[model samples]
Target chain A: MNNIALGRYLPLNTIINKMDPRSKILILLVMMITVFLPAGFIGYVPILIFIATALYFSKLKLTYALRALKPMIWMFIFLLVINVLVMRTGTLLISWGWFKVYSDAFSQTAYIIIRLTLMIILCTVLTATTKPLDLTLGIEKLLKPFEKIGLPAHVIAMMISIALRFIPTLIDETNRIMNAQASRGVDLENGTMTEKIRAVLSLIVPLFVSAFDRADQLADAMEARGYDPSATRTRYKVLKMTNVDYFAMAFALVVFATDLVLCWI
Target chain B: MEAIELEHLSFSYDGQTDVLKDISLTIPKGSYTAIVGHNGSGKSTLAKLIIGLLEPKSGTIKVLGQTLTDHNLKAVRDHVGIVFQNPDNQFIGSTVADDIAFGLENHCVPTKDMQRIIEESAAKVSMSDYLNAEPTNLSGGQKQRVAIAGILAMSPEIIIFDESTSMLDPQGKASVNEQIRKLNEAKNITILSITHDMEEAAQASNVVVLDQGTIAAIGTPADVFQNDALMSRLRLDLPFGLKAAKAFQAHGIEIDAVMNNAQLVEALCQLK
Candidate 1:
């Protein structure tokens, strides 16, 4: 369970890691949109290069980036199989009784796979380079404009950051609960579906009880520290966009513009 | 000026029986006071009431010479900070630096001054190195130190520790106790520690013993620990030093009353 590295930050002194989280998030948004611009396979070359450059500057290993894709391999295979069976537009490649394969099937599957891979890689790079707190702050600053429409941006950001902070603690609690239940002869593994669900309930009930208790204590602690949801509060870690952040943002925008122009042409 | 004053304070959760009854206590400025009691003795409730976390049914609370009211509650909270029993629950920040910045941010301290204040507070608790570390990466003691640094950054006049060290190991407890004492002595911050450890209470300048939701005894640690009848009734044990001293006296050794192990050791070493 600890091996899950989807959104874990790597503490390294690098240009990508030093960029402002807001700019990083914006760049990520631009990259995600660019990947789905209806541009042909040839149009993805620039995006792939941009991602490679980002990965290089982040100082993160290729294995870590690929690890984010490990959990989605099964889903990718499922999508490929579905596309192969459904799409029959292009010239026929092979046919075996009821099974059929076509050129467009492979091309369409490739397009989707490329888009998903690019999106996932971009997200992983953002999370790996930026601390979770900074990500939350970036999201909060981005959402501030919506506050005029009655959206509680600060509260939402607080909830997100708190949830992220408690993930490890809750994971530890889940393991402890699982162990305690296992000691009591609860077989969570190698059980029927219904029996497994019942066993999971035992673990879940205790986890929920502890989580709610922690939340209560946390609320009191926040109150004691003078946290008023309605009150105006200052920020400590201000997000300043350095020249490099601007450069990163401009680079992402240019790539997106290039992809849009390719699709129009 | 008194750091905290409670007059005829009474509180009840379900409105039937009171958790704390007519609890009137005054903690003077710059004093290290310990509130010790059994699990249900309402000592924790008293701490909460003083910090304005819980509203009293019938009483008045004053912090730093200002009466606690709805309008002035924020002001009161600004002067008082609390570190609760569970280190995991009270840590609101993802990292140590962010946690220390939490209270300062709440009070609207400018971002420019916040960095310096956070560094200084982290230095006080010897956690400057771990400022960027996550809470999960910290031990129970380090988390408490970070929590203390969070409060210290706010520069509160009085800090309440509600069984803060009860969840820590012996070493963690000792280190937190040392930090609390230093904050009181060196920084002149008043400390009101709610603890289950008599040894911890022995180090305080004054001790308040709560029994059945009332102040059973309030005096210096020496004066309060000397009441054997009351201690027995409250089911509280003596500090390690006094316990050992009594055991030594039982075996034909004359030892003077000592509040802690250091004094007991000194007395034993000076014996002819």
Candidate 2:
């Protein structure tokens, strides 16, 4: 269950962790665009190096970062296999009846796997170091300019962060409710497919009720504290860019620029 | 100065039986008032009404001298904060610092001073070290403290505890009580604690007992506790000392006006 590692922040003293969340978000965006733009493998060398260095500096264990990719490992493998079987070009490596594997296919598959893995790892690195609320504030700061166009940047950022925060909480709650139901002699496992589905269906109503109840109380609490969604509220944890942020942003820009040049070549 | 005043306040959920019927109450500034009642006695509804979460059908609520209306409710809310029941549910922010900064942000506190106020409020609850800690990761009492920190950071002149400690263990409740005592004493913040806990009611400067959506009794705890018939009618237990004195009285021994166990014990010793 912890393998998702979605909202879990690994507490470690590292330079990457010390960088401002806005800088990290910017770095993440640039890295994502750069890694995803190029079709060739040569461009990903910098991203791989960057991710490896970031993982080392983050003080987070390699296994934990890998765990964040666990849920998508199957998807990555499936896509890699599909690409290998579907694309046939360059030199033929193997042929059996209707199935044929090619050198070009292998390389393309490898490139995609590396790109996907790198993207997931980069995201893991971001979430693992920065707290969820900081990410929200960072996103809100980044989205502040859109407020002129009738966008509720603060509200949108808050919604995203709240969803992120509640993922683990709601998972724990689901487990609790399942355990409670199980204690009452409800067979959740070792049943027919329909029975299992029914058991799972039983969970949705309670979970919905609890979620709505929480939402209602939260609204009341927010209102009691004078929250006005349309008001122009000052941010308490404002995202400030300092020297380290500048250095990180510059480093990211260089990586992105290099990736662009490599793609042109 | 009146911290809060409710005049002729009546409310109902289904527009049927009035949950709160013509309730008139006044809490002076810097006073600790406890509203106690059994479950579904409308004490919580009254807390909601006072906080402007629920509007009464036929009366007015005033906080810090401003009457609460649809237009001015937000302004009044700035001066009054509420820590609700269900510690997990009331937390709107993910972390301790973020939650405290929430109200501050609403009040448009400058970013430069937000950290100081957040830290100061956390320190009031002795939770300064857990600024980055998630609300879910905290204990029930710690979460409640963080919620209180969120409210206190706004410097609300009046803070309402809507059965905030009902879900806490005895130790947690005691810690929250200690923090509340400090707030009332040091900051001169008015407290309106809605609870059914007899021990908490006994400790407050004034107690208002609600029964079936009406004020059954309102006075100093000593004065209110003296009305055993009303207390019994509301299905509220007397504090241990008072219960013991009553038991002794049933056995032909008289221990009158004993507010606590120590007093009852001394009176028994003197009689012997």
Measured on C-alpha atoms, candidate 1 has an lDDT of: 0.91
DockQ of each: 0.89, 0.76
Cα displacement (Å) at residue A136, model 1: 1.4
Residue pair clashes in candidate 2: none
- How do the predictions measure up, each by TM-score? 0.95, 0.92
Worst 10 residues of 1 chain B by lDDT: B46-55
lDDT per residue as tens, model 2, A121-225: 888899889977788888888888998898899899878877876776788888888888888777877799999888887888799999898888878887888
The best candidate in terms of DockQ: 1
Q: What is the C-alpha lDDT of each candidate?
A: 0.91, 0.84
> Taking the tens digit of each residue's C-alpha lDDT, what string does model 1 give over B1-272?
78988899999999999999998999999999999988889988888888787889998998888988888888889888999999999999989999999999999999899999999999999999999899999999999999999999988889999999999999999999999988988989899999998998999999999988999999999999989899888889999999898888889999898889999999999988
